[model samples]
Target: MASNKPAPEAPSRFGSEYVDDFATRPATAFGTEYGADYATDYGTDRGSDFGNDFRADETGPERAWEEWNPTEESVRPVRGKHRVAKQRNGLARSSTVLGVGVIAAVGAGGMATAQSKPPVSISLPDSIADNLPDAKSLPGVGALFSGGSEAEAQEAVVASAPLTTAGITTAEAEQGSTDAGEALRARILQQAEQQQDAADAEVKAAAETAAAEKAAAEAKKQQDAAEAKIAAEKKKAAEEAAKKAEALRLAKLAASYAIPTSSYTITSTFGEAGSMWSSGYHTGLDFAAPTGTPIKAIHSGTVKSAGYSGSYGYRTVLELEDGTELWFCHQSSMDVSIGQRVTTGDTIGRVGATGNVTGPHLHLEVHTADGTGIDPMAWLRARGLTV
Candidate 1:
């Protein structure tokens, strides 16, 4: 926005700083107060009128020209100001550039075109064209001349004639520049809409692809969790079924076994420390009972031996099918003979106080096929029998 302030007067061609400056100074300074100084400088006498001195000396005005000579500092403007124009717009006035161009063209070329003639375009470099003055912004210029460049002014150069109207429709041609401008604007807007739609479609496709990948990842995570849970459940079920089958097998084995003695109480267990026997530790289980109490066979086995042993008094040995041996010691009598086959609960001996026995009691021992004695109680419990 240019300021609406008043412009200072421009320096004139005839050594005038302002057009009204002469009226502000003294009416006659040269012939009166400074007359002696000027006369001495020019070697002439001062007079009210310069008509005699001007004819006599050809150097009258030339001698006085030194006082009015403008220097760079004296003529420098305080601000941009002009009388005819409130603001500076270009290199020069619009009419001045146009008139100069036309005069130069006429002098160089003899040809001239009428209103019916096609337009003639003059091309200039960008440096020159950008600096051309605007005519529409001038003081008194009418709408006849546009403020645009020469290219824009081509159609208006001769409005009565048609120039470059090849692509225009009949309605736009008759209607004026307004309708032609609207048609060009419509095409530009349509192209912009198509570009916008293409960008929106690309964004939508990217969003859908990302959504599908997220959904697939979530589903895979759930499936893996479900498969792991099913595997854990199957492992637990198999372990429980194995436990149930083992219990059933042990129940059937318990039905085939029985305790060796009746009306007896446990008086000594295996692995007991005592000095009474020769081995220092008791190697057999003892059942305390009244004399003549019957001792039965624990399991189905053959009689390995039946005799009166030295410290054991009368004794009996039974051998099971799996090469395990059962010995009955401290017995008062033996009933099973050698080579006799007996089932569980068959009488094999009688409890007594013979053979270094404490009171009346039956001593029992169990061994593997190698004759190594083990705890009778534990061995009998393994076969599912109490006592």
Candidate 2:
């Protein structure tokens, strides 16, 4: 182990002098250290140089300490330079912008949601109940929507909301939609009936028109036939009247052709003298005169005879083409010979009482060519001469 030894002391001073021992230099100590040590060391002296230095520091004498403001090192100027963007700064700004965009998107989405909402009400009419038919009365209708879900029932009720609120029964609401359906069925039936009636009326009218036309045509035809018959009858009557007039004219012509040969006082008619004469009382008219009275022809004719006869002394006969013979008997002189042509009022002979004559007279006889005797007065009356 090492010996524990203390270190040697350093040199010492006493007051204001270097001294080996301080008490031995009391005068130097008083004038130096011991004299003003407290006052000069800390400037606490009242009248020493140290005291003067303290007073000067308080009184600003000769600037013992200068006035001191804070320099750049103490309070550096507040930095005004714009800060650069870094990852940390960018993150803060991005967070603020994202917050505003989220707010705007939220507002736009809320408006779209409001616009897409459905209506809660519907409109319907009162008279809709009268149109529907009863579903209960229809065949197989009860099983149509039976055993359905509540959602199905809600849908069905909502669909039938128009009818139910209009006071329609559930049975009636199941039948149809509108009143127009019922009206259409009724209109169809009524139109069919009307068509049948119209067709029947048209047929009847056509038959009536045809009948009227036929009747009119028949009446016209009958009238035409009647007119034709009347015309034929009138023509026949006119022709008959003309024939009668011609006959009358011919009869008048015949009556004017007769003449009497002798002018006599007493005459014998043609048929009445037969009973009074010996062969005949007088065959002709008797003119009581002397003999030789002139005899003339009554009409133009050819002389057929001028000879004697048994009862009459001479006789003359004339004939005409119409087969009439004129005889003159008891002539005294015959001027007309046989085959001689004589004219009316020509002197043919002289009247004489030659044979069987009570007085001078002439017997005249008119005979047909077939020797048939007729009434001479009647025959002459037919020639249009009054005899």
lDDT of 1 by residue, 197-275 (tens): 9889889988998999999999999998899888888888877887677666656667778888889899899999989
Highest-TM-score candidate: 1
- What are the per-residue Cα lDDT tens digits for candidate 2 across 1-387? 232233332222222232213213344443354333322322233223223443311322122232247887987866664333223434643343334333332332221111122334654465775566666433344334476566665566555544323544355446652444454565578799899999999999999999999999999999999988998898999899987886788565544333545454445557674643676644454444446767777777899888998777788988986868987887888987899988767888887877766677777777898987766656655554454
Assess each prediction's global lDDT (C-alpha) against the native.
0.68, 0.59
Which candidate number would show the highest lDDT if scored against the true structure? 1
Residue 149 of model 1: what lDDT?
57
For residue 357, give model 2's deviation from the true position in Å.
5.0
Off by over 4 Å in 1: 1-251
Clashing residue pairs, candidate 1? none
